[model samples]
Target chain A: MSLILAAESLAEIINSYAECDASSVAIAAVIHVALIGAFFGLPAGIFIWAERKVSARIQDRLGPTRVGGRFGWLQAVADGAKLVQKEDLCPKDADKPLFRIAPYVVVIASFAAFMFLPFTDGWSAVSLDVGMFLLFAMLSLEVIGVILAGYASGSKWALFGGMREAAQMVSYEIPMSICALIPIVMAGTLNLNEVIHYQSADWIGVIPPFLHWNVFHPVAGPAFIVYFVCATASCKRAPFDLAEAESELVAGFLTEYSGMRWSFFFLAEYASMFLVSAVAAILFLGGWDDGFGIVRALKGNSTNVLDPGVIAGNLLGAGVLMLKASKLVLIQIWVRWTLPRLRIDQVMTTCLKYLLPMSCALFLAAVVYPMALVLGTGRPQILPLSNDVSAEAEMSTSSEVEVERAAADGEVT
Target chain B: MTIDQYLFALFALLTCGGAISVVICQNVVRMAFSLIISLASISALFFLLSADFVGATQLMVYVGGTIVLLIFGVMLTSSSALLQIRTSPAEGFLAAGIGVLFLSVFSFTVWSVDWDRNEAKLAGVTAVDVPPQDYNEASSGNTVRPLAMSFVGLRPDKAGKAPGYLLPFEIVSVHLLVVLIGAAYLARTKRRVSAES
Candidate 1:
């Protein structure tokens, strides 16, 4: 929905300056698509470099020290150039067409998932009402491509890897989704922007605004931990990366892939890692809400996109959001380097026996917490932080009115 | 043509093409892949209609969940001999005949319906109860609230005049739970028997 608004506004701006025969919406869309492409691609490259450096530091060894100077910041670029020049090959036994198409499917699914993710206020490409749900749906599509890649590779290791991935991803999704719902239950909306708005206000106008985030909520704090764990497993990162257990499977589903094809899988992996981390940041950490509340002061309830203050605030929010998400991503990388990979059975057990029940309990607590508070006190919130008392009262009264009206209508019928 | 029209044309063509390919493909895996394409495109059509929640649900439940399970089942159960089963000509003909008959009946029923009149009737039922927040707006397209309200027996679209599907929804939920439990129990018993043997 935001796509249409952005495009229409861009079109209006273009028309005021000059006349063009081309469709303005199409032009705007192309530009947005290009921006999104860069957003999706550049992060994967940087994350790859970070992963290497972080792992090297942990191992007490220098990693990629000379690729693009001392820190080897351009190592990912060098690797990409090399991969581009290398030959793309398909095994003779493989299903040729499916094998070729699988990497693209993975890339596209990961990229599409970004459309629903709001980096800052009013900045998502597609602002669907079911933003979180649609994002999950898009992310889930990635597994299909992995499964196809495994099967189409026509190797036993590849098939095993695919089967493991299918089982792991599908099982973990149940817990991950439930964990996500903990915040949704608290926020009372599925729109990511609305969820962030619910966390935008400071606690008691004295405490830091960041403390008001869902992560600080008693129930949601534990749920965030579980969500991050499941997010790691979903991204096929260790200690749950049984799908690509190097010693056992020779890169598993990627055994047959090389060159640009192989890099596509890496790109998808890093992008999804970043995507889930960003989602966690939005869902738990105060997304784009710098602890200082300076951005909110700048925004000041203005809905106008053209406002210079709003733009500055949004840009700052975007920076904060990216920083938080990047930190989470770093933690994921740290966990990958530090922990040993779990066996397939252990991974399944961790999800099914532990994480699933834990997340379910968190979800129940989140739901009951507010209701319990409402019953105990006059207000729904235990903390007399914000103006939630009046808001909760207004909501209850409106619902009560709705119930009365429904009862009257029933009698008439 | 407008962008919407062009998009509709694209997805519609892909849907039909995928369905046709599913039938024509000799390999079971390839057929499953085509089925995924068809189902995903159908979800895209739902999105185009501004049914955002339904579209996402369709993509998640069918394309993401069901198709993955179907592919997994195919890969696990099939041996090399069973991978490419050839249908008998007689069976093929019988199946094609049944499919054609079903298609004809569906088309005939669709063509016979006065869609405009039906739409007017639906609008009449819903018009008076249109909430302050317009859910059908292209920009917001928020149907989740209304959908949830209706599921819980409050028919927001009908101003609480019509009965909601709360009872049936509960029944279906219970039915699914039963099926899940039964499947687990059955699988457990088989594993125990195999262990004993």
Candidate 2:
């Protein structure tokens, strides 16, 4: 579709020609990781300027009115240069190796979150069925990096900040996941595209189902609300932003960081903030689809701009997903400015006391709601893609088949 | 040998080598780092074997969650101590000998496996395209659903084959709940109990 594909194929060819799978896979992984790195680095550059401008405006000030252009757009770029020029500091008493490595841990954990995230249908690097769970898993890991960063800094302030974060993040993760699960269960599948498609062509009252499309399905309606709240918390947006609440802990766990190392944590924070919003979009808001059904309608048409051949439908799907994810990311940034930060104990109380039970109830309700759909409708409401998988259960359990088949084959080793 | 086989060997060697290094390394921090490598390589091995879900779980839970906890604990406990806690040379040698013997026996059993026709079919997709996702949670095809369902007291996947781990799942959950509570209580600040000193 673009010059990128040509360049990518060329690189893949070069990568595949490497002497072994170890080297080949390693090369490919490096390229993939480099692209992600570029994504993080470039975005941080632009978003930093945007954040400064946005935050300044909220506080009624002229943000960055000096350097780059009419609006101080070059301020972030200038800041990057300054950070690069600054000396890297690790206290004499700081754990040497851990201090050196903590930033990379944060970066890696955030990057790994991309693994199970689907850009489009069947277009993921690894199309995992448990993409939902894996996203949570990787994201939960960000706490570890934060804690380690705090601890390895060897300052009393750093230790306090890190320990507090370790407790807060781990506690919040439970309620956050449980809340997020509400929408997922409503969708019946954890595959990002499937969840979005459920919203893509929703029918409504007035215009014979064509004009009155709604993304909000009854089952997923409340769940989306829940999902947004959970996503905000998961991203550590305002009201839940205790990890580095500036006034309280003197930037909390980020107190000791400066220069490029400090920037890594900020980059990770924003990237993860973007990532959570994107997940919310995919799960609850009907990813990539404009809810007009136009994209879905034009998907298979050959001459349509939406269908440019060679997995164009999938590409469009990816476009829709990314578009939605981007929009949601902007919303997260907006929310960050509008709300005041919550106190630490209050944050934990809101999660453990209030959100936790509500999420559990929603999960239970969603699970049985599907069963009711089956019974009331005289068929499963959700279209069964393949009945063979279900019928196979009647034939024999899968393990029996596996054991019998494995026993039959001579080259299983 | 196929690239797959070589990849398997490479990852296996990494896992074993890293694990051994973990045991041998006297520096506690380095030992934790080596454990991370070993566990990570084992996850890679799981991926190679087409256990993608399990591999991811390994990364998420073991490497990400547990390793972080262990490292944090290590750092906290080693606050005033040197970077490492050294064992006596005699103790180390005895442990190494026991470990070597156990590894040899394990390897011998593994090498002796009869990879029959059925067995080959069961786990033969070394580099195949992802299998069509059929919704047979009762079957091993869908690892995520069955695993989750198994935690909630069902063994649809292994219903006919082996004992359902329903009891174990409940026990683990309760155990986790208790541990969390206990940890919180233990870590909470309290007034000094003694004025005698």
TM-score of each: 0.92, 0.78
**Candidate 1 segments whose C-alpha is farther than 4 A from its true place:** A1-22, A203-205, A387-413, B89-109, B118-140, B188-197
Q: Candidate 1 lDDT, tens digit per residue, B1-197?
A: 66567667888999999998898787889999999999999888877676778889998999999999899879977975688888788987898999999999999999999999998898776535555242125444567877887788776666666788899999999999999999778756344576888
How displaced is residue B21 in candidate 1, in Å? 1.3
What value does DockQ give for candidate 2?
A: 0.23
Candidate of highest TM-score = 1
- Most accurate candidate by DockQ: 1
lDDT of 2 by residue, A1-413 (tens): 11012123334566666645345554555676666566556656666787888888888987899886689989878987889999998789887787878888888888778765666644444445666876787787787777778777878778777777777777667766776676666555565555554445533333222221112445556656666676677666676777677776787777878889988887887788767766777776666655555555556335433345536566666676667766776666777888888788887788778777777777787678768887997654444323222223423535754554454342333
| Model 2 regions more than 4 Å off | A1-35, A202-215, A301-319, A371-413, B1-10, B25-30, B68-79, B82-84, B108-142, B145-197
Best by lDDT: 1
lDDT of 1: 0.85
lDDT of 2 at A99: 83
Q: How does candidate 1 fare on TM-score?
A: 0.92
